[model samples]
Target: MAGTPTIFLHAELLPNIRQLTLHVSLPNSASEIDIRESTITLSESCRAVTVFTLHQDVELVETLKLPVKVTDASRRNLSFAGHRVDIGGTESKAQTAEYSFRLQVDPNDAGLTFTNKGFQEDDYVPWTASDMSTCAALHCKFCKQMIVDVASKPDTSSWQWKDLPSGNWAEMMDFWHCHKPDVHPDDKEGQKDIEAQNASVKGYGASNRVVATPRTGLVDVASFLVAESDCQNIKVLEQRPTSTSAKPASHDGKNARNIGCSGCSAIIGTEDSVAEGLRLYKNNIVVKHTGATEHVYETHSIDIITSSRFLDLIDHEGVRRFVIHAGQSNGILLWAFNPDLRYSSSSADHSIVSRRAMKVLYQNATDVERILEPENGVPTPLSLEELFLPENIYDELVLSLRRSNLLMPISARIFREWNVALLDRIEKRP
Candidate 1:
């Protein structure tokens, strides 16, 4: 019997863009592959088939198919032996070309929703150029860092803002009641602040309490600004504590610290004082309201801003754990198992139950088993093939981490370690 070809198909969700990536890996030589000649077709069954002719000189052809829809697609060849493609139209020695297809799913699809409270909904209001100008020149009061600027208006048409719900008195009261109970000892001042905010809300509603609204292309937590250095024009300042609204503590503590603009000693936002993991605040951020009679500027908490460092990985028990340290703030930890990959089984496994377990752990050949056992030599770098997680799961992991001010871009060193591990696994295979 002819054994199955060493072809692998995998799908991953792009966390930043909320797009689906379908990748096909072929075991054929690069000189025999020409993605430009490939044709991909999608079926009503939500499956896709790709046919490409390889080694045109010999008229050799191959077909690769998977269960997915191809929307926007592109192709690139990669060689594990450190081969680079020349841009000057020079043919180079490469062995593998990876074909990536972006899937087409409705923006209103149920799969995109995060929570019942509509936290991750796509209901964003466009931000006009004038609307962004209000806070363009403003800096943090404590750090004097330039938070926003006129040049920030890259896409005035699609850029939008969304209102984040501020918890009611009951929620706020409960948070303060439990936060640092030993330190507060007595809830007298905490109770007073809750009552005061509640009274203000009751009289003026949430409008009065909302101060500033920041705009982003998306409404996810990571969409907000995280690092003071991300701002082109900014000044750093000596760290200092800044006062904030007496709201119930969310993931971070009650007081926000270390989130000041570098350009000036202005307190733009609040951050965790210790790890400085994630910072949250609304200082000098405002949006414009176009009225029928005249232009009106108001402080609204419709949009919030934040900053944090890159992601970090730790080993717990036998499983590899991933987390984002929000500097001095609390870190955001991810769940052990990915829900999407839970039902998948490894095709290489002969036993049905073991195959099912493989699907649950690795999803497909494209899925890389998170560093289950770290090897001693040079750490392998992680690739897109290894971390191709589902969109919903990936988004939640990133959003939660960002909200806690712990979200960060994966670093190159970590990727190197993942790649090294991957090569070792491939070499060890009999």
Candidate 2:
């Protein structure tokens, strides 16, 4: 028997174009391999692609299976047009070579009977206020200390969990909720005062300000905005600004400080200087809901939590490109290419289970101002939002991006100046 060949395969189906693209990496020289002698087979019965290489030392055959049947974006079954696949290009480096191939596909004939639909979306729900029980207790994930003890209250029903508006709520309000001020034309001072009042009210308005009130835990997309008095076993430490870093500022334009778990001394979140509350990060703490058979906690990595928030921001703000700054020197330029994609890799152990991912084009941006110029024939001015992230969260996100970059073949790693990678959005939590 021939030994298994060291090969890696990545396949992407483009239903819109009726094409399937494949990238195959093998530990051999391109000159030694005869592309004409190799053959590819697409079996609808098994929903897999089998590749045969006859030019190698020993005949090698490998099959890449799909979790779901091949289907178009609209769930219509797609059949292979022909078994012949065209090699687009090949790149050889050192002792390894990567081959790119494209195959044509067509929609199934209406007369033919087919009973395979593509796999549905994952069976996990994104975090929201409804997912949290009224009597939930928030505890530090590191130390397991109860930070917000709402379950201990006699009447938990009184406490409300109100979801805050999206990060770009102020911009949306300017377009949808704008109204002319009612002030006399003669008094300019009165008009100015009225305009200021309309732009920002005490706790709500057109400014990017979300206020937290008593007895209410304001929920953002990724964190909880709770009153400082409601938090226990936590300490606030002053964050001094450095030369390369700007002074830490909260959403409400006040000097911000670090909020840490007193028991473990882990930085959980930041203090809300304006609202006088603790913005507890969801990934840093665990929540115990009411009426559970066992102690169930939903925990996520910083990258996963950050990616979910990015999805929300895209849905609400409709902005795909963003400049995220951790400090004056550390920054990342993110252009979300595809928010949803289904992919499978031969390198993974569970290749049968296709994963959901977000395709992104990223670049390390030390000087954000320099990269803001137009590139790739962008007609209109670029619309980018500056995101000020905590240093720890920024580091995690960068690490996640780099780790995923290694999973791709060298040819697909970079797109011009941006590095191409996929961020897996696997959600198993109910």
lDDT (Cα atoms) of all candidates against the true structure: 0.32, 0.65
Off by over 4 Å in 1: 1-6, 34-37, 45-95, 114-414, 417-430
Flag regions of model 2 displaced more than 4 Å. 1-5, 15-18, 31-39, 52-62, 71-92, 104-125, 142-144, 155-159, 174-210, 213-215, 243-247, 289-296, 349-351, 369-381, 426-430
Who wins the TM-score comparison? Answer: 2
TM-score, per-candidate, Cα-based: 0.26, 0.73
lDDT accuracy of residue 412 in candidate 2: 82
The C-alpha local distance difference test score for the whole of candidate 2 amounts to 0.65
lDDT of 1 by residue, 196-240 (tens): 797586644333433333333112222233333334444333433
Please tell me which predicted candidate would have the highest lDDT against the true structure: 2
lDDT of 2 by residue, 6-66 (tens): 6677876544455556677655665666656666666755356666665466676667864
The count of backbone overlaps in candidate 1 is 59
lDDT of 1 at 216: 34
